[model samples]
Target chain A: MIKPLTGNYAAAWGARLARVGVVSAYPITPQTTIVEKLAEFIERGEMDARIIRVESEHSALSAAWGAALGGVRAFTATASHGLLYMHEMLWWAAGSRIPLVMAVVTRTIGPPWNIWTDHSDIMGQRDTGWLIMMSEHNQEVLDSIIQMFKISEDPKVFLPGIVGLDGFILSHTTEPVDIPDQDVVDRFLPERRQPYILKPGDPLIMGNIPSDLRDNVKMRWDIHRSQERAKGVIRDVDREWAKLTGRSYGGLVERYRCDNAKYHIIGMGAWVGDMKEAVDILRDMGYGIGLVKVRYVRPFPGEEIAETLASSKGVIVFDRSVSPGSAGPLYLDVLSHAYIHGVRVPIQNVLAGIAGIDVGYDDIIGGVTMFINALEEGRWPLPSKIQWYFGGGEWWP
Target chain B: MSTERYLPLARPVVGVSGKTGTWRIERPVINYSKCIKCGLCWLYCPDNVIEIVEGSAEYVKIDYDYCKGCGICSNVCPTKAISMVPEG
Candidate 1:
C-alpha cells in the first residue's frame, strides 16, 4: 500500500517488513523517530521484534552484534555523533563478519552545535570495511534496507552495512513510499544466515586473536574480497528488486540523462535530487550535463562510473563532505577511477551543502553553468582545491 | 561439507597458547600419598592441566608438560597435596 511517510518512518517500515529480529540503538536527532516508530510497532504487536534499551550508542551496536552472532537478524539507527560513538563497534562488527544493518541519518558533526544534515559523519566511516549505501530519497531508504539485509547476510558477502539518509531533509520530510506486502518481501528476502551460530554446547570465539599474524592479514583480505564480491551481489539484488517491485535504483550508481551528454554531475545522498533537476535545466539552456547519483559508496561503481564519464568532456563531483585539507571523498574516488579508465577530461570537486546549507536546483544550475562556461572558454573550470559553494547560487573557482 | 568460517574464528580448544608449560621456570608436584582426591586442583587449574581419572588409584593426574607451574591448582587444593617446586 502507498502511504505518506518520513524518511525515518520509511526506515522503520523497512526493518519491520524485513522482519528484523532485534532493534538496539540510542536515540540521536533525526534518527530518534526511526527507533521511536519501531518501539511503537513492538508495543502494538505489529512487529515481533525485541527492542534493546541501551544507555549509549556503543552498547546499542554491541548488543545488536551479540544478537546477530546468536543467529538473529539485527538492526540499529543513529545519526552524526551517535554514528561516531559506534566507531569501535563498527569495526568490531564488520571484522567479525557478522551480518547486521544500520540506518545512518547523515547529520553534522558538531562543535558549533548544529543538528543539520551533512555527509561528513558517514563519509568519515568510508574506510572501515562496512558496506555503505547512501539514498537520495525516502523510498530508496526503505527499499535499500530490505536489500541491505539480503546482501549482507549472503554467505558470499557477510559484512555489516549502513543505509544512510540525509538528516531532516529526508529523515524529517514526508514522501510517498510503497510499503511492500510481507508475503512479497518474504519471497524476496530469505532467513538471515550466519557463518556460524553461537550455541550453549558448541562455543565459538568470534574476532578472537589469531595464532598466526598472516591469518589476521588473510581475514582482512577476506573482507576486501567479500566487498568486491558485494558489488556484483548488489547489482544482482537491485535487478531482482526492480523485477519484483518495478522500482529499479540503477544498482550502485543511478545514471540520469548520461546517454547523450558532454558532462555528468556526480553526487550521493539528498542533493542528488537537486542535481537531477539542475541537469535538466542546464540541458534546456544548451549545456550537455547529466547526473550520476551514487547509491552504494563502499563497493563504489567504479566500472559504471568510468564507462559513463569517459566519453564526456568534463565531470563535476559534488561532495557533501570533505576530508579536511584533501579533496572531497567522492571527487577523489571518481578522479582515481577516471584516471585509471584513461578519461583525461577534467573531473572537479564542488564542496556544497556542508553542515546543511540549503542547496536547490537553482544553485546546481548556476554552479554547473559556470563549469560548462569555463570549459567552453578553454580555461580550467575548477582549481586543484575546492571552496565551499555558499555563493547563494553561483558555482565558484 | 567444509564448515570453515569466512573469518579467523577460533573454536574452544586445549592449549590455545601452545603448551604454555614450556614457559614455566617451576613445576607443580602432586603427592598422591597425601591421599586426597578432592579434585580441587583439577577444578582450579588455570590451564586445565590437571585431570581426574574415575577408575584408577591415580584419581587426579597433572599434565606437567603443559602446566606452566602457575600453582593455582596447588593453592586451591584443600589437602595441600600439590606443591610447586623449582625446575632444573
Candidate 2:
C-alpha cells in the first residue's frame, strides 16, 4: 500500500515492522519524529513495546545497549549533537556485537548552533564499527531500517547498522512509501536470534572487562572480519528483499548509466537525487556523464567502485565533509581504490557542501567541468582543498 | 573458523599454564572393597575427566591431571567412594 509519509514516519514504520521491543532515544531536531511516532504507537496500544524517553543521547544509547544485550530487538535515532554525545557508546555497541539499529539524521556538527542537513555528523563517525547506509529518498530511509535489522542480526555480521537521512531534506519532507504488510514483514524478518544471550539465571560478563592484549587483538580482528563479511551480507540481503518485496537496491553503490559514459559523478545522501537531475541535463547535451550514488560508505566498496570507474575518462567526487590538510574523505577513498585497480581516470574532487550550505546545480556543473578539463589535459586532478562559504564570498575557490 | 574465535585474545597461542584444564580439586583412588558397578563419578564430572576401569570389578577412576577442581563427582557419589581434596 502506498502511504504518504515523511522520512521520519517511514523510519518509524520500519522500526515498527521490525518489532523493536525497546526504543531508548532522546529527541533532537529532524530525528525527533521517529521516536515521537513510536511513543504514540505504544501509547495507543498499536505496538506492543517499551518506548523510553531518555535524558540524553548518551543515556539513550546506553539503555538500548542494555536492552539489546538482554536479547530484545532494539533501536534509537539521533542527529548532530545527539549523535556526537552517543559517540562512545557507538563503539561499545559495535564492539559487543549487539545488533541494534540507529537512525542518524545527517546534520552539521555544531560550534555555531546550526541544525541543518550535512554529512559531517555521520561522516565523522566512520570508524565507530557500525555499518552505515545512506538514504536517497524517504522510501529508502523506510526500507533501509527494516533491512538494517536483518543485515545487522546476521550471525556472520553481528555489527550495528545506521540508516542516515539528511535532516529537513529527507526527514521532514513527505513522499510516497510502501509500508509492507505486518504479516509480510514478520515473514521476512523472523524474531531476532538470541545466540549471545544474557539471562539472569545464566550470567555472562559484558563489555569493557580486562583481558590480555592477544584477546583484545582477537576481538578487534573479529570486528574487522564482521565488517568485511557485512559487505557481502548487505548485497545478499538486498537481493533477498527484492525477491520478497519486489523492490531491489542497487547494491553497495548504485550506478546510473556509467557503463559506456566517459565521465562519472560520485556522491552520497540527498545530493544524489539532485545529481540525477543534473546527469540527465548533461546527458541531453551529449556530455556522456553519469552518477554513482554511494549508499554504503564505511565498507568503501573498493572493487565495485574501481570497476564502475574503469572505462570512464574522468570522475568527479563531491564531498560534503572536509579534511584539514588533505583531500576530503570521499576523494581519498575513491582515488586510493582507483590507483590500486590501476585505473588512470582523472578524479576531480569538489568540496561543495559544508556546514549546511545548500549545494546548487551550479556547483555540480562546475565540478563536472573541472573533471572534463582534467581528462582533456591528460592529468589527474589534484586533491580538492577548497573551502566554500556564504555571502557570495571567495575564501579558497 | 578464524584463528581469533578459538583464542579470546588476538595472540597466536597460549602456554599450558594458561590452560584452565590442568588444575584439580579432587584425586580419586580405586578402593576395590567399596567398589560397585555404579559409575556415579564418571557420570557426574562436568569436565568428563573421569574414567571407568574395564573388567577390574567396575571401579571408577578420576584423571586428576586434567580436572579443574569443580567438585561434582564427590558430591554425587552415593557410596562415599570419592572425596574432595585441595590441590596445591
Candidate 3:
C-alpha cells in the first residue's frame, strides 16, 4: 500500500512489518514521532509488542539491550544529545553481539542549543562497533531499517546496526512510501536464529570478565572480523529485498553517472539528493561531473569507493561535520581508501551544512566549480587544507 | 562448541564441585541445646553450605566442603547459638 508518510512513520511501519518483539525508547526531537507511531500501533491493536517507557536514553538502549539478550527482536530510536547519553551502552550492545536495530535522526550536537540536521551526532559514534548506514530519502529510511535487522541478525555478522536519516530533512518531510504486506515481510525476514539466548531452565553466563589479556584481544578482533564479513550479508539481503519489492540500493555505495565523468562529488545522507541535482546542472553545462552516494559508512566501502573514483581527475568530498584540527571525517576515510587502493586522485574536502545551515544545489555546484577551476589551472590542493562552503561569512578563529 | 572469543550461552556450573572449604580460615560450630528450629542460619548462609538434617543430633549441619567461613550465619543468628571457631 502506498501512503504519504513522514520518515518517522515510515520507520515505524518498517518495525511493524518486521514484527519487532520489544521496543524501548525515550522521546526526543525527530525520533519521538517514530516511537509515538509504534505506541499508536500497539494501542490500536495493529501491532502486538511490548513498549517500554524509559526514563532516559541510557535506560532506553539498556532496556533494548536486555530484551535482545533475552532472545527477542528489539528496537529503539534517538537523536543528538539523547544518542550521546546512550554512548556507553552502544559499545555494550555491539560488544555483546546483540542483533538489534536503532533509527538515529541525525541532529547537531549543541552548546548553542539547536535541533537542526547535521552528521555530527552520528559521525561522533563512528568507532562504537555498530554498523552505520545513512539514508537519502524517506523510502530509503524505511527500507534500510528493515534491511538492518536482516544484516545484523545474520549468524556471520551478529552485530547491532544504526539506520540514520537527516533530522527534519527526511524525518519530518512527507513522501510517498510503499508499505509491503506483513506476510511478504515475514517471508523475507524469518524468525531470528541467534546462537545463544537467555532462557529460564537453561541459565547462561554472558558478559563475564575475561581472565586473560589474549582472550580480551581476541574478542575485540572477532567483532572486527564479523564487521568485515557483514559486507556480503548486506549485499545478499539487499538482493533478496529487491527480488521481493523491486527496489535495490546498489549495495555499499551507489554510483550515479560516473562512467564518463572527469570530476565526482561524494557524500552521504539527505545532502546526496541535493548533490545529484548539482551534478545534473553541471553535466548539462557540458561538465563531465557525477555523484557517488555512500550508503554504508562503517565497513567504509574502501574498495568500491576506490574503484568508482579511479577514472575521475579530481573528487570533491562534501562533509556535513568537521573533525576539528583534522579534515572532515568522511574525507579522511575517502583519502585513506584511495591511498590504499593506489588511486591517487586529487581530493578536496568541502565542509558544508555544519550546525544545519541550509545547503542547496547552487552551493554544491559552486563548490564543484571551484574544484574544477583548480584542477584546470594546475592549482590542485588549493593552498588551505579544508574549504568551508555556505557558512554565512568566514570567521576564522 | 564454545569459542574462546565469546561467552557460550550454556549455563556455568551451578555448585562449586571443588572443595571451597580449603579457603575457610574459621568454621561455625552450632550449639544445638540453645538452637531453636527457626532455620535462620540456613537461610542466611551465603554459600548455601548449611543444610537442615532433621534426625541428626543437631538439627542443622554445615557442609564444610563448600563453606567459606564468611560468618554470615553467625551474624544473623538471633539466639547466639552459633560461633565462628578458628580452624586448627
Candidate 4:
C-alpha cells in the first residue's frame, strides 16, 4: 500500500516489517524521528521489539552489537556527531561479523555545528567494513533497509550493513512510499538465526583472542571473502524483493539512459535524484546525457562501474564529502576505477553542497554545463574546477 | 555474601598447555649464579606466581603452570637476577 511518508518514517516501517527484535539508539537530528516512530510502534503494541535507551551512540551500537551477538535481529540509527561517536564500534560490529543493520542519517560533520544534510558523516566511515548502501528517495531508503537485512544476514555474507540517506533532504522530506504489508514482509524476511548465541546449556566465546599474525590474517581474509560474497547476495536479494513487491532496484549501481549516451554522470544518495532531474532536462534538450548512481559504496562495485563508463565520451563525478588534500572521496573512487581499467573517458569533478547544504537544481545544471563544455573542448578538467559557493566562494574554471 | 573475582575454568583439556598459552605469564628462569637472594621477583609477582623459600631469599622459582606472563618480575630485580623466556 502506498502512503505519504518521510524517509525516517519509511525506515521505521521497514524495521517493523523486518521484525527487528532489538532497537538500540540515541536521538540525533534527522534520525531522531526514526526512533520516535519506532517508540510509537512499541507503545501502540504494533511491533514487539526491545527498545533500549542508551547514554550515547557508543552504547547504542555496543548494545546492538551485544544483542545481535546474542542471536537477535538488532538495529540502530545515528547522524553526524552521533555516528562519529560510535566510530570505533563500527569496525567492531563489522569485524565480529554481526548481521545488524543501521540507518545513518547523513549530516555534515562540523566545527560550526550544522544539523542539515551532507555525506561527510557517513563518508568518514568508508573503511569500517560495513556494507554501505545509499538511498535516493524515501521508498528506496525504506526498501533498502529491509533488503539490507536479508543481504547482510545471508550465511555466506554475514556482514553488517548501513543504509544511508541524506540528513534533511530525504529524512525529513515527505514523499509517497509503498509500505508493504507485514505478512508480505514476513514472507520475504523470515526469523533470524545466529549460530553464535550464548545459551545456558550450550556456551561459546564471541569476539575474543586475536592472538597472532596468522589468526589476524585468517580472520581478515574471512571478512574480505564474506564481503565479496555480498555482491551476489545483493543482486539476489533485489531480485527476490522485486518478485515479492513488484518493484525492482538496481542492485549495486543504477544506470539512467546510458544506452547510446556520450556523457555519464555518476553520484550517490539523494543527490542522485537531483542528477536524474538534470539528466531528464538535458536529455529533452538534445544532449546525449546519462547517469550512473552508485548504491553500494563499500566493496565498491568497481568493475561494474568501469564497464558502464567504458563507452562514454565524457564523465562527471559529484562528491559531497571532501577528503582533505586528496580528491573528493566518491570522485576519487570513480577516477581510480577508470584509471585501473584504462577507460580513457575525460572526467570533471564538482565538489558542492557540503556541510548540510542541499544540492539543488542549480548545482546539477552547473555540473551538466561543466561536463558539456569539457566534452566540447576535449579536456578533462583538473581538481578545483567548476566549484559551487553554497555559503562559501564560487570560482568558475 | 562477598563475590569472588572471575577465574577462568580449569577444564583438564586446558591443563598446562592451555594455561601457558592462554595467560600472558612467562616462565622466569633463575640463573643459579645470577641469583643472590634479591627476592624482588617474589615481592613483585602480581599473581603470587613466584615462590621464595626461606626469609634469606636465597631460593626463588616461578610456578609456570599458574603464572600469567606479565613480565613484571623481570623489571623489578635489583641485580638483573631473573630473566623471562617463553613457555615451551
Candidate 5:
C-alpha cells in the first residue's frame, strides 16, 4: 500500500511488515513518534508484537537482544544521547553476534545542546560490528529496514544492524512510501534463524570470561570474516528483494552519471540527495563529475569505490562526522580502501553538517566548483587535504 | 583462532574462574548445634556458592571453587552459628 509517511513511520511499518517479535525503545525527540505509532499498531491489533516500554535506551537494546536470543526477530530505535547511553550494550549485542535490527535517526551529539540532524550519532557506531545503512529517501528507509533483517539474520552475517535516517529531515518530513505487502516481505525475509536460543530448563551459558585470551580474540576475528562475507550477502539480498519488490539500490554503493567522468563526489544519508543535485548543476556547466552515494557503510563497497577513484582525476568526499584527531570517518574509510586497492589519486575531504547545520545544493556546487578549479589548475593536493564547509557562503579551502 | 567452536557460547561448567577460594583470607565454618537451617546463607550468597544440604551430615554445602569467602554468610546468619575463621 502507498501512503504518505514520515521516516519514523516508515521504520515502524518496516518492522511491522517484517513481523518483528519485540519492539523496545525509549522515547526521544524525533524518535518518540516511531515507538508511539508502533504502540498504536499493537494496541489496535493491527500488528502482533510486544512493545516494551523501557526506562532507558540501554535497557531498550538489552530487551531486544534478549528477545532475539530467544529465537524471535526483535527491533529497537534511539537517537543522540539515548544512543550514547546504550553505547556499552552496542559492543555486547554485536560481539555476541545477536541478530536484530535498530533504526537510528541520526542526530548531533550535544555539548551545546542540539537535537538536529547529523551523522555523528550513527557514525559513532561504525566500529561496533553492526551493518550500517544510510538511505536517501523515505521509501529507501522503509525498504532498507526490511532488507536489514534479511542481511543481519543471514548465517554468514549473524550481526545486528542499524538503518540510519537523518534526524528531522527524514524523520519528520512526509513522503509517499510503498509499504511492502506483508506476504511479500514474509517471502523475502524467511523465518529468522538465530545462532543460539535461551530455554528455561536447558541452560546455555554466554558472556563468561574465556580461559584463553585467544578465545576472546577469536570472536572478534570471526565477526570480521563474517562482515567481509556479508558484502556478497548484501548484494544477493538486494537482488532478491529487487526481484520481489521491483526496487534495487544498485548494491552497496549506488553510482549516478559516473561514466566518462574525471571526478566523483561521495557522501551518505539524506545529504546525498543534495549532492546529486549539485552534481547535476556542475554537469550542466560541463564539469565531468558524478555522485557516488554510499548506502552501506560497513562491509564498505571499497572495491567499487577504488574502481571509480582509479579512473577519476580527482575525488571529493563530504563527511557529516569527524574522528576529531584524525580526518572524517567516511573519508578515512574511502582513503583506506583507495590505499589497499593501490588507487593513487588526488582526493580531498569536505567537512560539513557537523552539528546539523543545513547544507543545500548551493553549498555543494560552490565548494565542489572550487575543488574542480583547483584540480584543473594542476593544484592537485591543494595546500591542505581537508576543508570546512558551514553553509551561508562560508567554507575554508 | 578457535578450535571446535566458532562462536562464544559455552556450557555451564564448574570452576570457571579457576578455584577463586584461594583468594579468600577468611573462611566460613558453620556450627551445626546452633544452626537454625534458615537457608539465609544460601539466599544471601553473592556468588551462589552456598547450598542447603537437607539430608547431609553438614548443615550446608558450599562450592569452594567459586567461593571468595567474603564472610557474607557469617554476617547474615542470625543464629550466630557461622564463624569467619582465619585461613591457616
Candidate 6:
C-alpha cells in the first residue's frame, strides 16, 4: 500500500510487517513517534505484540534483549541521549548475540542541548559490535528495518543491528512510501531461527563469564568473524528484497553517475540525497562528478568503495559529525580503505552539518568545487586538513 | 570445540569447562535429621544443582560441580537443615 508517511512511521510499519513479537522502547524525540505508532498498533489490535513501556532506554533495550534471548523477534527505538543512556546494554545485546533490531533516529549529542539531525549519536557507537545501516529515504528506512532482521538472524551473523535515519530530516518529513505486503515480507524474511533458545526444562546459561582468558578472546573473535560474514548476508537479503519488492539499494553502497566520472562524493544517510543533487549540478557544469551513498557503515564496504572510486581522479567525503581533534569518522574509514587498496587518489574531508547546521545542495556543490579546484591547481592533497563547510569556519587545523 | 567458543544460540552447556564450585567460599551442608524433604532447596537453587534423592539416606545432594554456593537453598530451607559452612 502506498501512503504518505514519515520515516518514523515507515519504521513502525516495517516492524509491524515483520511481525515483531516484542517491542520495548522509551520515548525520545523523533524516535518517540516510532514507538508511539507501535503502541497504537498493539492497542488497536492491529498488531499482536507486547509493548514494554520502560522508564529508561537502558531498560528498554534490556527488555528487548530478554525477549530476543527467549527466541522471539524483538525491536526497540531510541535517539541521541536515550541511545547514549543505553550504551552499556547495547554492548550486552550484541555480545550476547541477540538478533534484535533497533531504530535509531540520529540526533546531535548535547552539552549545548540541541535536538537536530546529525550523525554523532550513531557514530558514537561505531565499535559497539552492532551492524549499522543508515537510510536515505522513508522507503529505504522501512525496507532496511525488515532486511536487518534477516541479516542479523542469519546463522553466519547472529548479531544485533541498528537502523539509523536522520533526526527530523527523514523522521519528521512526510514522503510517499510503499509498504510491502505482509505475506511478501514474510516470504522475504522468515521467522528468526537461532541455534540456542532459553526455554523451560531446557536450561542454558547466557552471557556468563568465561573461566579462561582465551575463551573471552575467542568470543570477541567470533563476533568479528560474524561481522565480516554479515557483508554477504546483507547482499543476499538485499537481493531477496529486490526480487520481492522491485527495489534494491545496491547492497552496501549505492553508486550514482560514476561511469566516467573523475571526481566522486561519498556520504551516508539523508544528506546523500543532497549530495546526489549536487553531483547532478556539477555534472551539468562538466565537472565529471559522481556520488556514492554509503548505506552500511559497519562492516565498512571498503572493497566496494575502493572499486567504485578506483578510476576517479579525486574524491570528496562529507561528514555530518566530527571525531574531535582528528578527522571525521567516515572520512577516516574511507581514507584507510583507499590506502589499503592502493587507490592513491587525492581524498578530501568536508566536515559539514555538525550540531545540525543545515547543509543544502549548494553547500555540497561548493565543497565539491573547492576539492576539484584544488586538484586542478596542483594542490591535490589539500594539505591533509579537514574543512568545515557551512559550519561557521573555513578549516580546522 | 566450536561450542566452547561463543556457544551457539548462546546455550550454556552442562559440565563443559569451569567448575563453579570453586567459587564456593562457604558450602551448604544439609542436616538430614532436621530435613523435612520439603524440596524447597531444590526449588530455590539458582544453579539448579540440588537433586532430591527420595530413597537414599541423604535425601538431598548438591551438585558441587556447578554450584556457586549462593546460600539460597539454605535461606529457603524451612527446617534450617541446610547450613552454609566455611570451606576448610
lDDT of each: 0.88, 0.81, 0.89, 0.82, 0.90, 0.89
Give a tens-digit lDDT track for model 3, residues A312-379.
89999989999988988999999999999999888999888989999989888877887799889988
Per residue, candidate 2 scores C-alpha lDDT tens digits across A1-397 of 8999999999999999899999999989979999999999999998889977788999999999889988999999999999999999999888888899999998887788888888888988888889998999998988899999998998888888899999988899999899989988888886796448676766465654445666776777887888888889889988888888888877788998786788899999988988988888888877898899999987778888999888987788888887767867888889999999988776767776788788766567656765576567765443333334341333254
Give the alpha carbon lDDT tens digit for every residue of B1-88 in model 2.
7533421212222233454656555555445576675887788777776788887664666655567767677677777766666555
Candidate ranking (DockQ, best to worst): 5, 1, 3, 6, 2, 4
lDDT of 5 by residue, B29-80 (tens): 8898888788999999999899888887687887876778899899999998
For candidate 3, the per-residue lDDT at A48 reads 91
lDDT of 5 by residue, A97-126 (tens): 989999999999889889999888888888
lDDT score for residue A242 of model 5: 91
DockQ for all candidate structures vs. native: 0.51, 0.06, 0.37, 0.04, 0.63, 0.34
Clashing pairs in 6: A196-B9
Q: For model 1, what is the alpha-carbon lDDT of residue A254?
A: 92
**Model 6, which residues run further than 4 Å from truth?**
A390-397, B1-88
| Positional deviation of residue A49's Cα in model 1 after best superposition, in angstroms | 1.0
Q: What is the lDDT, from 0 to 100, of the residue A228 in candidate 2?
A: 84
- Count clashing residue pairs per candidate: 0, 7, 0, 4, 0, 1
Enumerate residue pairs that collide in model 1: none
Superposition error at A68 for model 2 (Å): 0.5
CA error at residue B32 for candidate 4, angstroms:
37
Better of 1 and 2 by DockQ: 1
Per-residue CA lDDT of model 1 for A317-390, tens digit only, reads 88998898787999999998888888787777899998889999998877777777777897764564465687
Instruction: Name the best candidate (by DockQ).
Output: 5
Candidate 1 vs 2: which has more lDDT: 1
Weakest lDDT window of 10 consecutive positions for candidate 3 chain A:
A388-397
- The TM-score that candidate 6 achieves is 0.88
Kindly list the per-residue Cα lDDT of model 6 for residues A1-397, writing each as its tens digit.
9999999999999999999999999999979999999999999999999988889999999999999989889999999999999999988888887799999999999898989989999998889899999999999999999999999889899899999999999999999999988889888887787757788988777767676777777778888888888999999888888998999998899999988988899999998898888988889999998889999998899999999878989888889999989989999999999889988887888888988998888888877887799889987667665887665335553
Reference interface contacts recovered per candidate: 0.81, 0.10, 0.45, 0.00, 0.74, 0.48
- Listed per prediction, chain B TM-scores read 0.80, 0.61, 0.79, 0.62, 0.82, 0.83
Per-residue lDDT for B15 in model 3?
52
Report the lDDT tens digits of candidate 4 across residue range A1-397: 8999999999999898899889999999989999999999998999899899999999999999898988889999999999999999998888777789999999988788888888888888888889998999999989999999988788877789999999878899999999998888888886784435655655555555444556666667777777777888898888999999987877898889888988888889998888999989888888898999999997688888899889988887888888877767888889898899988777677777887665676668766776687668765464444444363235343
Error of 6 at A202 (Å): 1.0
